[model samples]
Target chain A: MRDSCSRELTCIARSDPRIIILSGDIGNHMFDGFKAEFPDRFYNCGVAEANMISVAAGLALSGYRPFVYTFAAFDLTRCYEQVRIDVCFQNLPVVIIGLGGGLTYAPLGPTHYICEDISILRCLPNMTIVCPADQAEVMASLRSSLDHHGPMYIRINKKNEPCIYTGEPDFSLGRAQLIQDGNDVCIITTGVLLSEVIRAARILEERNISACVVHFHTIKPVDEIMLREVFSRFSVVVSVEEHTLPGGLGGMIAEWMIDNRIKSSDLIRIGTGDYFLTHCLSQKEARDHFGISADLIAGKIADGLNK
Target chain B: MALAAKISGNKYRSFVLMSDGECNEGTVWEAVLLAPVQKLGNLIFIVDNNGWQATGRCDDIMHLNPLADKFKTFGWNSFEVDGHNFEELLNIFHSIPVDSEKPTAIIAHTVKGKGVSFMEGDNNWHYRIPTADDVTRAKAELGLE
Candidate 1:
């Protein structure tokens, strides 16, 4: 995630010299390549997340698009007030890339968990929330974010996930990409969990359960028009995500369904269910434990259609 | 009225006592605080001792105990200066030899609404902006007439 962020920022810095990078005592070593490429554009703001956000706001006011990166928890929650008042509230165009969304840092304990960032960030006006699926999606999202105005929150995973698209797919702002086609079920996925959803769709396909996969990378101002189109195809819609069921992709999809009066036969949400996981585990293991794996998702779809 | 008179009369310095209502209400307190910091460089901030907010009071909303200590923490060289002493107020402000680096705070110990015939140490005035009659009475009491 940091690699992609640094790369995008470096590319943007080459063209737009006003681009600056601020890290909260981390990412300096990882961003060495960026520093080497654009020496004047990088600044490690130490452990001061609040000060970094404030400084980024100042830099943005002075016509610099400051990219602030840090661990998801400290980056989003620790300096939430600063992001809210200083950046989003004031409509500053600063890119805040929060690394390790969901339980990406599973073994690192609860402090590292980023389950709440989506909800908190989405609630802010003029703040664009993005959770790209994979490398291609990352680049596309980064490009879009750079070209975008106002504050943006890009939640990224820690490890390299599966490649969602072959190359740079056509990504539009607030538009969902329909990766597969099916009539029985429509699987809406966010973040890197799109990989799991795609895998689940293939598994469901073998069992004669036609499932469509819609990549909802952009959370806020979600592709409601695309959703209505997707919903018309499938009777049973299941929203899959790495985040908790509440205030995540599932909740957003549910809200959209409710608002549009699209009453699917069954709405199965695959995610963490009201409990933070304890005991060290990998991302896959954590998803499995929370009943959000490919097999579980496939089973839920089949069962929902069957019922 | 006292504040207006002091400002209009060309007084070199003045003080503003406030409650938490002024602080949390928005930039009114910030503007008030910055006015002194930006202005006289000699103004003193005295937050009245009777802790009160709106529904309950200061201790109810949030106990800011060692109140004087909190002001000191606000980049202001502050201590508990006296409340009712004309001589103490004069002496305290006179004795504060200015160090331009830090602003000075004198948390004067005073009742919330002191020297009032009816209302004294009351939280009602926190949000109640003075009316025409209230302004006239306040002006009369402060010798503005």
Candidate 2:
């Protein structure tokens, strides 16, 4: 995910000189290629995320589209106020890319975990949240972010993630892609959890319990039209995500369903409970422990549908 | 970049006003170092040195004594003035000090709640807005009657 984003940034800077890269002092070595290509456009703000956010906002207000990159812990939660007041409130064109989102840094403990970024950022107006599932989606989301005139957040994992899309499938903003079609239950997933949700869908397929899989890379605008259509048609809708339950993808869908008065037989939310995972574990282990892995998701969905 | 790019695009300089309580944030200092490194003379900042924070006095919460000295240490031209004085503010804003190599930080000494007799030097008014009667008494004190 980092490779795809950094390489894309270099290409972007060549065409658009107004696109500046501001780092929170972590990605200087990784962005060496970017620095070599466009030396004047890159800045390292030391380990100061709040300062980076304000500086990015200042740059954005001056007609430059600044991309601020840092780990999710410092990027979203630490500098939330600056992002809210300086970037979001002012409606600046700043792309905030948070690496190691969710449990990608699970080995580092809860301080590095980022289960609440989507929830917190979505609360601010003029903030668009995108959790790209793969390389292609990352590329598409980066390009689409340029077209947006306000603050956009792109959450990514730490290392090499397998590409889910065989080819770039008409990636557009505010539109969820329908990965598979079925009727028993609809699984709406976001971020890195798309891969697991896809696996869960396959398991349900083997059981002859068809499940519709919709992948939402953009979590804020959230393809509400398609979501409405899916919710009204499907009796059972299951929302999957790598975030906490309250204001994550599940809560978003619940809001839409409740507002539209679309009554489902069951709306199962597959995510973390209302507490932090306060232990050392790998990303997969954490997912399994939290009952958000593919097997657990499939089991929960199958059980709910069968009942 | 905001300085060079924006200053190039138009005919305006940026002025920022913030509170001394906000100095607890490390990012404020990071930005402080950048202003001079980038040589943004067009950017002028006014720090409201009210000496009070959310919980207690700023000095009790964090070590921010001699606020003007701290700005100078960050390579900025720092000065202190009566924040309530309109003329003093106008005089400082009128011209940048000669031989100034960096951005100017004006540390404006102020009270948390000024003008109102009851709320002055009190921390409660910092969190709570003035009630209707509070405003009435304040108006009388300021000779608005």
Candidate 3:
């Protein structure tokens, strides 16, 4: 996803002279191609994420589209106030690219693990949060960012994420993409976890339970139209994400259900528990530990349906 | 922004007014290191060195004395001036980019509250809003009466 973002950003920079890339001393080699082409457009703001965000905000204020990129944990946590006040409060056109969303950097420990980005960023006004499912969605999101008006947070995995879409699937901000149609259950997932959810849906299908697969690339300003449709149509709606249960896809859909006074469907949220990982684990191991693996997700969905 | 202007061929200059207390933040130094590397001559940072922070004196709390020297050491075109003097400020503002390839950092020395006899140099003024009577007395002190 990061590779796709870099390549797409370079492609965008070719046509749009206003495109600028700012990094927090990370991904120097990853962005080598971009720097080689437009040396003047790329800025390595050193290890200071706060100043990088403010600098991006300053550039955006000057009519330049600046994308601030860094590890998701550092990008959002270390410089949260700057992201909130300088970027979101001012409603600037700065695309904050958070690499290593969720536990992609789990082996690097909790310092690099980010599961609260969506929760915190969602509460900020004028902030649009998009967690791309795969490389194609990453490119599409970057292209859509060019036309977006305010602050945007693009949470992405590091690299080599499983491709959810064969090609770009008519992507747009705040719109949900339906991967497959069913009636018994609707699995609404976001980020790189879409692959696991799809696999889980197939498992449910084999069990004679028709499961719908819906991909929510954009988390904030969530697909309300789809939420209404899915909740009304399907008796069981499951939300899966690589993030924690609170303030992620599940928490968001739960709130939507309550606010809209829709009690027709039983909503089950599948995410990491409200605790940090104590032992060192890989991304896959962490998912399995949290019961977010495909087989586990299918079992949870079946349990929800039986109840 | 200064870098943006330079790259876009815009002659517009970007000015940032900062407080001496704010210098304690790491972000300030991050930008301080960046502007010089980019040689953003179009950027100007004016620090209001009033010596007082929210709770205590700036030097007593953080020791940010010789602020101009700090910027100078950081590869900026540093200058010191009286913040209250409009003529000095205008002159310094007009003579920006003393070095064409360096960013400018102006350390403007000032009192916490100027022109008001009772309020001047009082850190309490940082949070204290003047009452009706205090306002009248302040006006008299500044000859606004």
Candidate 4:
């Protein structure tokens, strides 16, 4: 997904002269094509994420579209003040590309794992959060970011993520993409976890339980129309994500359901617990440990249907 | 912004006015180290050296002495001037891009509160709000009676 983002950014910069890339001393080789082609547009702002964010805000204020790229853990948490004040406060057009979203860097330990990015960013005004499911979604989101008016946070996985879309599906900001149609249950997911959710849906289908799969690439400004439709149509709606349960997609859906008084369906949130994982594990192992793996999600959905 | 102008081939310049105490933040030095490498000649940073921070004197708190020399060491074209003097400020502003390939930094020596007898150089004014009588006296001190 990160590689796809770089490629798409380079493609976008070819036509948009206002496009500028700012990195926090990362992605040196990944952005080589962009730098070679548009030398003046790429800026490696050194190991200073805060300064990079502020500089991006300044560039945005001056009619330039600046994309600040760095690790998901450091990009938002490390320079949160800069994003809130310099970028979101003024509602600038700065696209913050957060690489290694969720537990993609699980082998690197908890410092690199970012499960709270969606939680923190969703509360800020003028801040839009988009967690693309795969390389296709990453490319689409990057393309959509060019026209997005306010500050946007694009959370992406590292690499070799399974492609959920065979072809480029019709993509837009703040709209959920329906991957499959079913009636018994709906599995709503965001980010790379969509692959796991799809697998779970297929598993449920084999058990004679029809499960719908919806991909919520955009967490904030959620697809309310889809939410209303899913909650009204399905008896059990499950939200699965690689992030923590609080203030993530699941939490956001829960709030939306309550505010709209949609009591027809029971929402089951599948994600990491409140605590961080102390043990070192691989991404797959970490997902299993957090009960967000395919098998566990399918089992949870089946149990919800039985109840 | 200066880098944006340079990349887009614009003649516009960008100025950032900061307080002396704000220099204590690590991000300030992070930007200080970067602007020179980018050769952002259109960028100018003005530091209002008021000699005091929130709790105590700036030097006593962080020891940012030789601040101008610090920017010079970091590859910026550094300058100093009396912040209160209009002519000095105008002269420094007119001489931007001192090296034509380096960012400019001006250390403007200033009092905490200028043009007022009671509030000048008083760090208490950083957070304290003046009473009505104090405001009247302040106005009188500034010859606004």
lDDT (tens digit, per residue) of candidate 2 on B1-145? 4476455765456678998877766968878988899877667889998887654677764678888999988898888999999899889888675434588999999987688778789876654668888888989988898
* Winner by lDDT: 4
Interface RMSD after interface superposition, each candidate: 15.4, 10.9, 12.3, 12.6
lDDT of candidate 1? 0.75
lDDT of 1 at B13: 49
RMSD of 1: 17.7
Q: Score the docking of each candidate (DockQ).
A: 0.01, 0.05, 0.02, 0.02
Candidate 4 lDDT, tens digit per residue, A2-120? Answer: 88899999998999999999987567478989989999998866555777899999999999999999899988988899999999999999999999889998877888888899999
Score each candidate by Cα lDDT: 0.75, 0.85, 0.88, 0.88
Q: What lDDT, from 0 to 1, does candidate 2 have?
A: 0.85
lDDT of 1 by residue, A153-234 (tens): 8888866788878877888778888898887788888888888888899999899887878888899879888887877766
Q: Is the docking of candidate 4 incorrect, acceptable, medium or high quality?
A: incorrect
Model 3 interface RMSD over true interface Cα atoms:
12.3
Q: Rank order by lDDT, top first?
A: 4, 3, 2, 1
Give the Å error, residue A177, model 1: 0.4
Q: Local error of candidate 3 at A226, Å?
A: 0.7
Please list all clashing residue pairs in model 3, or write none if there are none. Answer: none
